[model samples]
Target: MPVLRVHLDSDRSTARRVLQLHQEGKIHHESREAAREQVWRRGHTPAGDPTFVGITNGRRHVQLLYDVEVYSDTVL
Candidate 1:
């Protein structure tokens, strides 16, 4: 499996967008802290870069976290 290393864009607009995605249930993490912790614990390797960070349910659901954007992945 390839690790998706997420890099967050620390800007106002991006924050708003992330919040919106969370509200819409596009982002499964209950909070940014949880997301951060998960990433930290998983350790950012294999992905080798922050631009491709993501977390998955080990099934069909995957969310890709890119700079200033969040994408819901339908295909693994």
Candidate 2:
């Protein structure tokens, strides 16, 4: 299974939104810090990979990344 790493800002709303999205079938597995670190340990870059997603909060907005396979209306 793929993994998604989510980093939210101090604002709790953003994190809630991400959780909601995940539960709503808009995203695949939620990424854990440990999991992400493990991937990095294996010498893998997240960019252009179809098995990882990275979500972060920018200076003023939220950013979302989804695996190509999970970028659809169907749930995982």
Candidate 3:
């Protein structure tokens, strides 16, 4: 955690997606591990609610926290 710094990508598109997910029950308040995996697997995670992004400070890859979650019923 010491090497990682999270700066949320606040875009209108991302926020709009989050709102839609919430309304459609696509977003879930799940564990951070899954959220982490989703972002870590891809350099940039899916943007929704709290958007995802990665910043590398030299050799260190910043791990962004997914404050919101998506449903498991459907594949993201």
Cα displacement (angstroms), candidate 1, residue 61, comes to 31
lDDT of 2 by residue, 2-72 (tens): 34343323344655565576667663334333344444554554443433344555665655543422222
Per-model C-alpha lDDT, please? 0.42, 0.44, 0.41
lDDT of 1 by residue, 1-76 (tens): 4444454434444455665675666753433544454455554322222332333323433343542222333122
Candidate 2: residue 52 lDDT (0-100):
30
Among the numbered candidates, top TM-score falls to: 2
lDDT of 3 by residue, 1-76 (tens): 1122234333444445545565675653332345655544544443444433322232333332344333333333
Query: On a 0 to 100 scale, what is the lDDT of residue 25 in model 3?
Result: 59
Each candidate's clash count: 5, 1, 0
Q: Candidate 3 versus the native: TM-score?
A: 0.27
lDDT score for residue 14 of model 1:
48
Sequence-dependent TM-score of model 2:
0.30
Model 3 residue 31 CA deviation in Å:
14
